[model samples]
Target chain A: MSRLALPRWSLIAALSLLTLAAAVGSLLYGAVDLSVARLIAAASGEGDRVASVILFDLRLPRTILALAVGAMLGLAGAALQGYLRNPLAEPSVLGTSNAAALGGVAAIYFGLAELHPIMLPLLATGGALLSLALLFILSGKAESPLTLILAGIAVGTLAIAGTSLALNLSPNPFAAMEIMTWLLGSLENRSFDHVRIALPCIAIGTAMLLWNGRALDALTLGEDAAQALGTDLRRTRLRLLIGTAIGVGGAVAVSGAIGFVGLIVPHLIRPLTDRSPSAILLPSAIGGAALLTLADLGVRIIPTTNELKLGVVTAFLGVPIFLLHLMRERRIW
Target chain B: MVNIVLDHVGVTLGRRAVVHDVSAAFAPGTLTGIVGPNGAGKSTLARAMLALVPANGAVRIDGTDVTAMPRADLARRIAYVPQGQTLHWPLTVERLVGLGRLPHLAPMSRISDTDSAAIERAMERADVLELRDRIATELSGGERARVLFARALAVEAPALIADEPLASLDPGHQIDVMDMLRAEAAGGGLVVAVLHDLTLAARYCDRLLLIDDGRIVADGTPAEVLTADRLRIVYGIDAAVETGGEWPTITLFGRAP
Candidate 1:
């Protein structure tokens, strides 16, 4: 690596190591103290039954769930930031995540959540695709930054209002109670089932999104220039829309509407850009994963009778950092 | 072969007719300058030539109508350097210039050695090689203009069209850019520019198309078209001409008869 690339590689390496250490800590130091030795013994098939149950059944899934969800959020968020060229543009901005949440809530209310294991996720994915299509249609031919933002805001508001109406008309306590989690967002009791449902979608979305980094780099100049450089504007936009829908749709299908992971992570990692879009993308994802994982970890450490919502933690962390960025942007402007 | 031909072109943005019934030709290996007073449709005419705006008539490049040609294929033949484009992102000059190679690069092709060499040559020609690694946002206005020009040059297009590129530069740099455009035409590539300075137009351009009130008032060689009468009629100025060495530099006295 050149002198310039060394810092980023080391930063990624250091963060990856920290993430692994934290995952182990998360497994070991949760509501009950469970040692890694016990975890290993459980894995090796010889340990105390209760300890094995705690380590293998409860803590392992929860800890691993956090890592997977964190990575998904980070990857999805980074892609949105890169494509929109706006640090503030998150997956939720497009309304896809909110729509997915509405779909999940609707599925649960219809009593189909137990009938078909993946019904919520499937319906949620459909909702996400619908919202994405709505956004693109509203955006029209002018995919300029201001227009895209306006379209996103319009679609997101509609989705939220629709979600509210759906929850308000339903009298079921479970359906009504789901509204709070869907809006505020959470990852409590997220199990291996959740992991299995979301992973393939996230992986496919990540590959599609990461492939467009060069096109995004070309777009930093402007759409006209990118077109001149052989980046078909319509094609690139389609890729972004599909990938964002799948990745974010998958995460929100399981976790409900998580927000701000995409909004804050890429901004934090922009200084390491090295003026290359591809170089910035993976680091941006790493930063996103680390930020979300740590934020989730914070939710765990905070004292509460019930677990704090993960979205609440992100908003608390993200809003203040966003203000700092706004102040900095104001200075620049 | 037709390098670039505008057929009865007109452009009306919203409600105002900016360019009306104006037609022109930019043959290959020739320097053409679009010159007129402010609001004389120089830019609108140029936009029609590149099919950037929806106009009544057609813009044909090498006998193929630009409207009918694939946008990418058209982009390969013609490179455009827009004037007064502010850089909102802090990109390196090399990175900015390297984008010009995008037209020729296949989907799977990384930046090849050929692309690098072309970019290097364009930077050197534009005298921005030393500042390759410098952030474009930090450059002086003239430097940025050249960097953008170098980016278009790196496209290796058969024709280049620049819009009022001389408006922001000092006298020396303005002449330098004009001379570069002249050299580009001399090297068998067509160059079309909207120039503000009448004296530079007289000296550097092979042909001049002067416009007034959305109409082509005059078009020909420097001596046949840029007469004192037409200058006063179009510009409402008392024009004076002085011969220095080999070039006749026309000076606009003022906005007075």
Candidate 2:
């Protein structure tokens, strides 16, 4: 036990450093490069006006959003995996993000989002909640990982189908194209307003997930044993479902449906923490922030005629890592 | 130390009664074995005591209705080792055992010195101290069983209920587990085990409750409960029961004619 603590702490520390570096990289490396001196001058209110506007107003919010959204996805993934007792369980895998996306698309399609900006996230959160309720109803008490995943796939397919139908039926092609880009997920051009919209929901949701850490640990013994250990399984399930909805909902609203960070982060960090579900929460959050921020950074730096989509980059990075982990730890399932 | 009382406890699953009108009292400082045929509701009855399953009648722990008691408080009084050997995560043995301290912890609080001591002691008692750092899912069947046993022991609850604790263990580990249950009872905790092995049950249990079709058919000392007539009637087998040794031994010959 004494031996285990040191390495986990160091891993967390390393992840924190990586996130910090990523944040700094997000701030400094952009379309218009700003030196450390220029950034300092901007902070002190004496730099180029364009540089100040770009640094403070543009890059900072985008960077913070990346961190917050990444952390939410990561934490939600860990919590869902722990609650479901399935290593492959994540927001994307469970169709919550797609559901949220459908909700956001519906809000835009119906012009409710034009009435109020918060309507998108609220509707997205509602969509996520609906999907979870559907999942519970479809899967029932069996709680088998396969049934849950199949149900999730069904829900995801339905939501995606709905989204596509809405796009196809839209009279305005430009609007459809715009929504498609947003759905593809990018960290570009987001201001503090998007951050304000997402931060509270993400923060609250993340707190809810983290609060159930001990319960998740107890759950490693399975539902019956966990209840015997005094874990309120029903309450834990409620919190997990609601928490993932709010976090992933807000994330999907602002940045579109980023995939695989949640799936990849926990599995990567589980070994470092001796596979204790509770111990993996914080590291998973930080690791997620690092991964998404780095991915976002990669999208910015890669010299493409059209900038790479954030979601595409993450899926590219994450799917291979997930498959590798699957191959390496085939016995885990 | 607390006593558990089940009064007319009945469990129905989807309009079908799985266990019906069963009543029993389990006192501290005694190890009781519940022996029964397959699907005779032994596990269900055990689960009902801890309110893991909803039951028709009352189950009380020291005069308090278990359903009325808060989950954590009941957990403080009872620790359960479930039947299956399946664990979802491949957590280290020490970490898995440490999960027993959950009921005793405040939400978001770290493990205290007392929790650590209890965990260490449980691992030592279960003889899994040497395997503390090993990944639990990677352990052999018997080894994983022992690790799970240590997890239950770490709870330090007044009553311990184990469902089929000897199910997959070899003879030596089975004996070791039975002895551990006996030791828990001797140490002033109520220990109830759902066991299929009549010989082991007769050997270690201070009392035996034999159930058939979810009803307690015989409840007495091993010598009384393991009678040839009862064995033939309940199990449809012919058995020679020996009471000369310190532990009652049963030798099965053939089908009852």
Q: List candidate 1 stretches off by more than 4 Å.
A: A1-29, A32-34, A37-72, A105-117, A166-176, A276-278, A301-303, A327-333, B7-23, B37-41, B48-73, B211-217, B232-248, B253-257
| Global lDDT of each candidate | 0.77, 0.88
Error of 2 at B103 (Å): 1.5
Q: What does candidate 2's lDDT look like per residue over A2-83, in tens digits?
A: 2344476798889999999999999998778899999889979999998899898999999999999999999999988888
- What's the chain B TM-score of candidate 1? 0.94
> Which candidate gets the maximum DockQ versus the true structure?
2
| Candidate DockQ scores, in order | 0.34, 0.85
TM accuracy, model 2: 0.94
Each model's iRMS:
2.4, 0.8
TM-score, per-candidate, Cα-based: 0.85, 0.94
Model 2, residue A9: C-alpha shift (Å)? 3.6
Q: After superposition, how far is residue A282 of candidate 1 from its true place, in Å?
A: 3.0
Q: How much native contact recovery, as a fraction, does model 1 achieve?
A: 0.19
Query: Which regions of candidate 2 deviate over 4 angstroms?
Result: A1-8, A110-119, A133-151, A172-175, A329-333
Q: Retained native contacts per candidate, as fractions?
A: 0.19, 0.81
